[model samples]
Target: MVELLNAPNIDQYAWGAINGCEAASLLEGLHCLGKLTNVNYGEFLKQMPIDEGGNPNYGFGGSPYKNQAGKFEAIFVKPLADWAANYTTYEDLSDSGVEPIYQSVEAGNPVVTYVTVHFEKPEIETYPFGDVAINNHAVLVDGVNATQVHLSDPIDGKYYLDKSKFEKIYLSRNMALALLK
Candidate 1:
């Protein structure tokens, strides 16, 4: 199964007119998963997931919002044939640290998967910026795996994300359904 996660360098995602909610909507519309920061989460623990040790893992759950609830919800997954049909096998990716956006890593072709929209806050620090919080950006999860996935921001920058962080941010089936249409 493929999962999508938000990159650490979310600050550099500034592009186009779409907002965080809009970007998420676009990804969900495509039936693809997205990894992004929940801007409403706030600072200190702003969009950062806490580890067992209580240290911020810098990760959080992700999902599609503003769309019809049952449209993407599938009944069952056929293992090898229909990975997309099963919601449990698939996961939404994200991280509290800066990471890159991607879809999949199948050979050389990078296919676009989901769309992400993030809001930028100046209080947090992030890549391409120092001392300034660079949060709130959107990325499309085009492809992925246990290693990395292909990602593209609206500004046309492409990159990859490690799998460990990808596992950190995922929405539960119930959580996903709550955000769906």
Candidate 2:
């Protein structure tokens, strides 16, 4: 088993309602890599880009303060990666599967990965642009073992998820961002 100690556990609710998971996960990853310290959540939230039209590929879709349906209410790896580049090096590992994730963890890097709320079954909603997981949530993968994956979740803090179950939800989108030192 390998676990990176001192990974930050940030609650999205502390920053916003149901929309700050991405930002919170990013914060956790950056902090885990020692790239950021003494951050102001308000200032960090203000700097993140928001695409009100529900295009998560470019920026966060919908308001970070609202939880209404059909607003997409999520952000993907691209925008997060671009924004994180300002602080530290990052790699967009979308569709790269679980191997790289373990590798990143093994290298003492935390990965910000997309998964459903509480790591539950994904609820996908298809839009004209693309499919969006309504329960989409982001968490920092900070540890790995033969049977379990540990996470610093934005909403639930830190916990261990079954490796098989984690991989199932993880591969659904296979979206991940590796924060490198």
Candidate 3:
């Protein structure tokens, strides 16, 4: 078992928003990487591109505070990676599977991964560009053990998800982002 100690536990709602889990998780990863010390979520949110037109690949879609039915409500690995690049090196670990994810935790790197809210069963919504998980949410993976993955969830804070269950939701899109120092 390996864990990245002192991983930031940020609540998505603490910053006056119900969304922005992606940015929250990214901030946790950045803190884990020692890339950020004094954190201001409002400033960070301002730096992120808000793509109200539903382009997950380019930037965040929809309102970070509320979910719109037709717009893509989350940001994917690409934009997160692009944003993190300004602070430190990053790995676009999309479709890379679970082993590398665990390895990252072992190496003391926190990974921002896309999983369903509360780790529930995924509900995919089809977009004109492609199918997207309607319940899509992001969390920072800060630890891994023999049978569990430790996460700093932006919505629920720190918790453990069974490896099998985490894998199930994770494999739905197989998307992960990590910051490297």
**TM-scores for every predicted model:** 0.28, 0.94, 0.94
Residue range 92-147, candidate 3, lDDT tens digits: 78899999898878887788999999889888767877988888899999989999
Clashes of each: 35, 0, 0
List the candidates ranked by TM-score, beginning with the highest. Answer: 3, 2, 1
lDDT of each: 0.29, 0.84, 0.84
Give the Cα-based TM-score of candidate 2 against the true structure. 0.94
Give every collision pair in model 2.
none
lDDT (Cα, tens digit) per residue for candidate 2, span 44-146? 7777888777788888888778866666777889999999999999888888899999998889888999999987888987875787788999999999989
Model 3 misplaced stretches (Cα beyond 4 Å): none
Instruction: Judge candidate 1 at residue 89 and give its lDDT.
Output: 33
Better of 1 and 3 by TM-score: 3
RMSD of each: 15.0, 1.4, 1.3
Q: What's the true lDDT of residue 47 in model 2? A: 78
